[model samples]
Target: MNALTPQPSHLAMVPFVSVANMLKIVNRIGPAQMIAGIAAYLEDDFRRWEQFDKTPRIPAHSRDGVIELMPTSDGEIYGFKYVNGHPANMARGYQTVTAFGVLSRVENGYPVLLTEMTVLTALRTAATSALAAKHLAPQGATTMAMIGNGAQCEFQALAFQKVLGIDTVRLYDLDPAATAKAVRNLAGSGLTVVACASAEEAITGAQIITTCTADKQNATVLTDNMVGAGVHINGIGGDCPGKTELHRDILLRSDIFVEYAPQTRIEGEIQALDPDHPVTELWKVITGQAEGRRDARQITLFDSVGFAIEDFSALRYLRNQLSDPGEYIELDLLADPDDPRDLFGMVQRARP
Candidate 1:
């Protein structure tokens, strides 16, 4: 260890993993607490939302499905996720969607955490739902109707329970097997789960309705007649351009809210509404700049398109739980030059 010997000046890198490890990390904190924590973080970010560089998510739509890139930063930390939604992939032993995300520091433009986001997406979507419900749902929303009993169903149920104190859930899906799977996954959770024969049967007397179906078209999961006063509908599945859950009449019947209006207008349930139709953004309600749930009888809808800020909040939550246990892969993407003018020499020397 001579004084003249120069040690590596860069920080260590982080390795990404599959959804298996992610499920354990999120479970360790408990989904409800995680959602509550994430909601607070979201509030803080929304207070300064104007500081971030917001962009419309980038989407590559094909005949089969759509893939999207959502990137955002508060001029300090940058994060992005590579997620593909292919409904046909379920039969191929793969999820209909697959995802991974990177968290990077803006100071040196280096990634701090590279991890799987499929599980994180599920967790964050639920958190986002509860976050919106915190502001939009009527007082004492104890019952929730969960539509689409797929991979996301369990997380949404737990999040609403943890974040909004929901104790009862009614489940409905086109496939009875899917609903059975959801009930089995949620075994011993103390949530009163009722399997319903139809979407109308599930949403009958629920305070909150969550739609997470995987259909790639504009399917009407909820119509105007099915909606009740003071119910907060958390629409999840219809996230892409051509996909939607709630009918146009349902949106027209409720005070629809969204994460980012400019982006949601093109992707959220608001896509079916008139261009000039009025709606409130979630951040505004969170910051108290706008009113939420004006009365107990006002119908509300949180048309969730799943914004990047929620992912930013989720990444930050994961970063806090990690202690950098020396678990990462180091890639040499940048070269250290002995002298400022020796850049080319450094590259040539680094070549095999």
Candidate 2:
């Protein structure tokens, strides 16, 4: 069907990059470098924002957890991830989440990379959070209060410390063990970590308040009274229709910011606000089309729903970084029959 000289092969070769390879790649590049590279690509994509085929995230919700699919492409490369968030997974000796993703070319529909996305998601989520905070948080913000101490807590803390000039993190969670784990992970990073007993204690005098709790309901992790002026709230966990972290009154009082208006309208903290309520897109701030932090008294909230373009940027970055010899394992997703029209003969030859 291609009408070319050499017929296509039945075995289409694609590469599979494993978790260890990814770890090596990420470690060599470092989180700061990766975040910077991803930010540059995100800005470039935002400049040509009209070229992308964007769609809302697809989510499947159950009583215990939710699974989501986020896909996006720019007519050249297509990427999608299958990730599940089950808070109870840890109770059963499994991680609270697991994920995998595929990056494919659009022309011939050949997969270029298939990698585990569980760790990758943690990386990207933190990168996105820091990216937004960099644009929205007050200049020279050094202290942060991380309200959730789950698996993502350490990544978020490091991203902010490395990218946003944050030097101290006040950590708190319902589970003291989780907070202890986060503190231990951050050891030797030259950053101070304070494990507070309550959310109120953690948030006190912090420059940025990051709410990343895993509850899948409309829970108020950040209340109106706890939030003060000039605080940049990075809301990462409330990313579903029924899930939220900030109280509705806080959203009404703060200057809300989001990734994509349409998608965030349903999934972000904006879901609690009226449809007509005004909010700014993070891309606008990145492009210098809109103002971020104008005054010390104005509270800014980044209602992050983890947009597809971020993943696209990340996969693009990962693919570029792993361009050395034999960084991935090749696979055959399609079978080639040597002759385009001799499919029946090939099947007959394989009858044995």
Candidate 3:
């Protein structure tokens, strides 16, 4: 609290994790270990998935991009994220995607933690991908092909390395500089990084294939002849309608796994398929109710569209990590009065 500003009751204050503090949290824990830690939290949440409310994200679409609100609750606590995806922003010297989120108590409708999620989203997205692969990827998978080396490329490589024992990453992007940037970032991460010219070359000898292009149209980053049997495809780029990365034929060949079937049917790679297409919910697989990786020759696809439960788990992990003393600041977010019904008086008292 600033000394010059009028101090409100404790109930009016909320812990706010700024971008700098978020970076502190990530660096203090180490990226790979933090990704693994978040993956563990995700597993715990997924086990009790039915305990929380679930729904598709509410999105406002436009010609340039889309903005979305993702909300969920676990009876005791509620969390929501406000995020936007503007692929054109990259060319305009801005982030293609940015986000912020809040976690609040259910007993009283007050925010407990508010934090920037642009960085956290990248981490949680990678963690979710790694967590799903842990259940669905081919056993003993050593190499991964990361197509579209954008903001998420290095994080995915590090997460797979820490969580799934992947040692080699082959990267390819429409722009050579993007691949170079990812290669430079992953140099000292104890992984053999290879920059490939084509997606076909990137997938050679790679047990896992990750597509994360940032186009807002139906672009086939991977075709039927390109993807073979026994490879786990992590579809990360297809988070909105008409913005898909994999071809329809691949979805037909692969055993699709998704966070929420309803959301995936609308926003994920499965959008190209019929409404009744069969897909295994990732929670069911994590809870051991459904099968993953049925056979070595069977193709597995995690059609991830960044669900609300995953973000909720990420906020839970961040709150836990900040339980100890840290540099996070507090903001006077709520208007608290001595009498619950005297909200107007609270404002009047601040007129000095």
Candidate 4:
């Protein structure tokens, strides 16, 4: 067979990590270690933020749900994630969010890796939140109030414990079953998990508050009076237009940090603020170009909207871990023909 021939060769196969393999990878690496590994990659990329091509995620909104494409590149590799958000799916016995992603070599524009990102997204989101908290949260803060106990609750709790040395997490959700589920999942995690009766009780002694509700509207999950001095609020649930968690007055009193200003202005907790309202970019804090946590009394807020570069970092990390042969599967994704230009010949040969 010639170089372009349709032969069973490794060149025509792409490495893919399915949901099962992804779970195995996480199990092998351990969830805390995986979160830390992804966080290290995220920190390295954010420090060299200027080297990346960044853009706001492109979204298509419908009455019931939304679909989005988040893409970014670092000159050598390009990555993008195809994700959907359908809050109604949970009631119908499905995950509210599901995703997959691709990593490609920029030179030849060939895909090098294809993997399920639903689990990876949860890992990266929690890692990114912990990374931000490391910079913005008060030093020696150990307790976190998780306002939403859905799919992301356990991940967030573990990430904080692993990255920020948090030992306790107070959980609260509108649905009591969610709190019960999180409590069960976190049983052996060595964390002091408490199911709170209300949001006020969740934040009683917690220094960090994470809001990750699945609602798609501007719900005042955390009001102004609830938040107090020296608390770092990680607002993750307010990730799209018309979706937010905190009250506007709380935003007015806090030093807001965000992934990207342009995107956060439209989709994050800062969306409640005026267009000219000032916010700090989280990358700058990591790079030491800007300040984080100016004082203990200052309320710090990370208006997280899940940026493309974070997904790019996750894809990059996954590609780096593919050296183990058994960690992934190969799929015949490319067509090869005896002649580079003879695409029709390859199709004809496959016909019985």
Instruction: Name the candidate that leads on lDDT.
Output: 3
The Cα error of candidate 3 at residue 70, in Å, is 0.3
What would the per-residue lDDT of candidate 3 be over residues 1-352, giving only the tens digit for each residue?
Answer: 4565557889999999999999999999999888899999999999999999998999998888989999999999999999999999998999999999999999888999999999999999999999999999999999999999999999999999999999999999989999999999999999999999999999999999999999999999999999988999999999889899998999999999999999999999999999999999999999999999989999999999999999999999999899644748889888889898988887786675
Candidate 3: the clashing residue pairs are: none
Model 3 lDDT-worst window of ten: 1-10
True-structure RMSD, every candidate: 3.1, 3.9, 1.5, 2.1
Candidate 2 segments exceeding 4 Å error: 1-11, 341-344, 348-352
Better candidate number, 1 or 2, judged by TM-score: 2
Q: Is candidate 1 or candidate 3 better by TM-score?
A: 3
Q: In model 4, what are the clashing residue pairs, if there are any? A: 4-337
Top-down TM-score ranking: 3, 4, 2, 1
What lDDT is reached at residue 347 by model 2? 69
Backbone N/Cα/C clashes per model: 0, 6, 0, 1
Model 4 vs truth, CA RMSD: 2.1
lDDT of 3 at 64: 89
Q: 53, model 4: CA deviation in Å?
A: 0.7
> lDDT of each structure?
0.83, 0.84, 0.94, 0.93
> Relative to the unseen true structure, what is the C-alpha lDDT of residue 182 in candidate 1, on a scale of 0 to 100?
89
Model with the higher lDDT, candidate 2 or 4: 4
Q: Residue 101, candidate 4: how far off, in angstroms? A: 0.3
Error of 3 at 37 (Å): 0.9
Clashing residue pairs, candidate 2? 9-336, 10-334, 10-335, 10-336, 11-335, 11-336
